[model samples]
Target: MAVRAGLPRITARVHLDLLQSEDGRRTAAELTRRLKVSPASVSVAVNYLVRHGYVRRERDPQQRRDVYVIDDEAWYRSVVLSARQTLETARAALASAEGAGPDDLVGQRMARTGAFLERISLDLLESADRWRMLLK
Candidate 1:
């Protein structure tokens, strides 16, 4: 659902997840087998990710089979950027209400909502750090 809302196609995220769990970059045949999807569907999704800069493809030197690599940094950045945008929008709306008048009931509610968004943004940022730490 999140991938559908973002720049990456849903299948791209699935492919990325699979590649990350597996030892090496995956071939279309392998992906088709693992995902149980048609070759055409996998091709379209891979092409979309490649075109959108979320993945890169390379041919194996020995076998000449194409392998798709997930751009982990790009994936991380995309998620972080999205989280920032969501929090910023909430903050902006809250700020507008607060600026109208602090004593207003709407302003008070907005202020509370703003605090909640800020906390959520911090937690999300921290989660990325923790994820990286676990990898280490």
Candidate 2:
């Protein structure tokens, strides 16, 4: 499911494992051991997840290690991030269409694409809000 959403296979697996964890959090070592992958591989996957707002890294001060977490808010954050990115792309497409001129067939196509993306982005943003409310 995470892979279909654009995560790499290993990263998706790591995310699924974390989601199934009792506390929605796991240490890097635990992830490596559970997934039967190298520590480096776990690290890379978690790093990618963190960067993309799917996970957060917290310092386990007592254990002197990092714990990766995917809390309820993670989904909301990810959706917002994705929506914003899509909206930015839509804006760029629309601008490009304007630069291409009104009579250009390619420009018309670009305009339509931009409108579609903009609508999808707005819908995602609205859905995220509704889901967030339900989660709370």
Candidate 3:
């Protein structure tokens, strides 16, 4: 599911594994062992997930190791981030449309695309907010 949503395969696997873990957290060593992947691979995947807001990293105080966690709010954060990116794309598209001139065919298409994306982005954010309220 994560891969389909555009995550790399290894990163998706790491995410799923962490999501399924009893504690919603796993160390790199644990992920490597469980997923039968190299430690370096897990590191790269986790780093990507962390940077993308899909996962968070924390130090395991007792073990002195890094743990990757997928908290309950992970999905909300990811959706919000995605919506923001969409809005950025929309803005760029609209700017390009303006530069291309109002009557140009390409400009018209871009304007429509930009409007659609902007609407979708706003809807996603609104839905996320409603779901967050319901969940809480």
Once fitted onto the true fold, the runs of candidate 1 whose alpha carbons sit more than 4 angstroms away are: 1-13, 16-21, 47-66, 71-79
RMSD (Cα, Å) of model 1? 4.7
Better structure of 2 and 3 per TM-score = 2
Clashing residue pairs, candidate 1?
A: none
lDDT accuracy of residue 42 in candidate 2: 94
TM-score of 2: 0.90
Q: Rank the candidates by TM-score, best first.
A: 2, 3, 1
- lDDT per residue (tens digit) for residues 1-136 in model 2: 6678678888998999999999999998899999999998998999898988878999999999888998678878978998999999999999989999779999999999999999999999998988797655
Error of 1 at 9 (Å): 11
Candidate 3 local lDDT, 8-107, one digit each (tens): 9998899889989998889899999999999999999999989878789999899889988986787898889889999999999999999998999999
Tell me how candidate 2 scores on lDDT.
0.90
Give the 10-residue window scoring lowest on summed lDDT in candidate 1.
7-16
Model 2: residues >4 Å from true position, as ranges? none
For candidate 3, the TM-score is 0.88
Report lDDT (CA) for all predictions: 0.72, 0.90, 0.90
